[model samples]
Target: MELTWLELFIIVLASFRLTRLLVYDQITQFIRSPFFDEVEEEDEFGQKETYLVPKNRGIRGFFGQLLSCHWCTGVWCAIFICALFFVYYSIAFPLLLVLAVAGLASIIEVIVQKWLED
Candidate 1:
């Protein structure tokens, strides 16, 4: 089926938002490592950064790796969202629409904050 520009945009935005939520939000905290801690990291620019990461353990470390990388989780999220959109087009569109709006707003918020910082 053909998608309108807005619909396409919504799909992209929803995928992005869902990926971030699953990877970073407190709602999925249970799946994250409880013992993980944030440590100071330095970038190429020498700017100090911090990130909370779990220690890697082979075989059992799949979930930790999955939840940490947006590219990995985003692929799954996009597939699920797209399947839901196709299977329940009429029922899911409104919810997807709302998520798209929220996602766009959040992205704009981030860009604005970055601009203001500079």
Candidate 2:
């Protein structure tokens, strides 16, 4: 479907939020997995740290895989974004815009860091 500038902007913002939430949000906390383990991990800024991560198992491991992948999350997020827009565009519009901008800033930060490193 053809989208106006505003709709396109909303989709961009909402997509950012969707990608971020499914990958980094607290929703993953509620999922218990047999392969869950915590290990030392370095922060993006180069600080040493640790975090819990889940290992992919058999075919049943799809949920874990989905939760761990931002791209995969993005697809689901896109679907939700559209649904939210259709259901309540007024409220969803600003909310997604704010969250999506935050997500975009994060991406820019990483890109800038990589550029500096290179």
Candidate 3:
């Protein structure tokens, strides 16, 4: 099945937001908490930041590492979104639409924040 430009754009944004939701959003902390531990570390500038430390050594560790890395998670999210779009467009479209809108909003929010900061 071929996608129009708009559908491709939606898939990209939906994947982006889904990846962010899984990897960085506070609301999904519970999902990550099972595989990782939150550890606070001090940077060179003396600023403390929380990081996810994997809590296991085999399959669990693999999954924890996958969930924590944005690029890793994004690739899977893109594949999942694209697969679902191809296999179940009617069911996936509404959810993809929501995620795409959210993704666009998130991009705008970051840009605006940086613009204001400068």
Candidate 4:
């Protein structure tokens, strides 16, 4: 069966949203795990000292870590599937347009995040 660009966009977006909801806590814990790698003790300033965990990823480990990064994995899968769809339909412009929009959105998101952090 043939699918339109809009349909593909909806499918990918919806899949990402669903996976996000399901994996939120695991994702959060994965993010927070780095803090635990340090020796939890008092600093000279009487505050806590912590160190960031350096994750080691080699070959299979790299792919495993990537697979565990839920949102990134979702986006990667979605892009691959969209690329396959484009190849099947022999439509280059639509894929390029989608990638362009994604890039714009990423830039906007980075700007918004920076603003929020300030």
Candidate 5:
């Protein structure tokens, strides 16, 4: 198998989507669980308020963080693919394929976000 940037990008994108479809909902439930929520103060006045701080469960955040997630996944996938490219030829090809799937997933996520906004 030949390692190529395009292939890697496709793999990552696909992984991202699969992760979201297959895993995000369950993870989101866990994240939104009462345990994940915490109270915080706005100022020294001791005004307390509850906030939902999302847990970092990798692809679980899928559509959770919106554009930020898309960008983060995209950038991260690209970097990892590049690194793998320089690592091992055998692993590089497979890794690139995975990264490519993830990359495609990110693109789809971005598109969905835009549609939602409209």
Candidate 6:
């Protein structure tokens, strides 16, 4: 099946947003809390950042590693979204639209924040 440019754009945006939601968003912390531990680390500049360390072995560790890395999660998210879109376009379109809109809104929000900061 061939994907049109618009469909491709939607899939990419949806994947990106979904990956971010799974890996970085506070709303999904409960899901990650079981597999990973949050560790606070200080940089040379004395800035502290929270990091997720895998807390289990085997399957749980695999999931923990997957959930903690944006690049790894994004690949899976893109594959999952694309496969769903191809197999169930009617059902997936609405979800994809929501994710795409949210992703665009998030990018715009970041841009506006940076503009304001400048």
> Which candidate would rank higher by TM-score, 4 or 5?
5
lDDT of 5 by residue, 1-118 (tens): 5746665556556456534533344544553353243547586777777765544556534434532344554555456555665676576666556645565757788899999999
Tens-digit lDDT track for model 4 on 17-103?
434533344545564454233446788899997643324655545544554567676777567656665565456545545654654
Best by TM-score: 3
Return the clash pairs for model 4, or none: none
Better of 2 and 6 by lDDT: 6
How many backbone collisions does model 4 have? 0
* Residue 79 displacement (Å), model 6: 0.8
Which structure is stronger by lDDT: 1 or 2?
A: 1
Write out the backbone clash pairs for model 3: none
For 5-114, candidate 1 gives per-residue lDDT tens digits of 87778888989888888888788776675535568989999999988775567643666677778899999989988987889999988888887888888889999999
Q: For residue 83, give model 5's deviation from the true position in Å.
A: 3.6
Query: Candidate 6, TM-score vs. the true structure?
Result: 0.87
Please provide, for model 6 over 12-100, each residue's C-alpha lDDT reduced to its tens digit, 9 standing for 90 to 100: 99998999999999999898888888799999999999977987798889999898789999999999998899999999999999999
Candidate 3 error regions (>4 Å):
40-50
Mind sharing the TM-score for model 2? 0.62
Worst 10 residues of 3 by lDDT: 51-60
The prediction achieving the highest lDDT against the true structure is: 3
Model 5 scores what on Cα lDDT? 0.54
Worst lDDT 10-window in candidate 1? 29-38
Per-prediction RMSD in angstroms? Answer: 4.5, 5.8, 2.3, 8.8, 8.9, 2.6
Better of 1 and 6 by TM-score: 6
Error of 4 at 16 (Å): 4.0
Q: Which of candidates 4 and 6 is the stronger one according to lDDT?
A: 6
Better candidate number, 1 or 2, judged by TM-score: 1
Error of 6 at 82 (Å): 0.4
* Comparing 4 and 6 on TM-score, the stronger one: 6
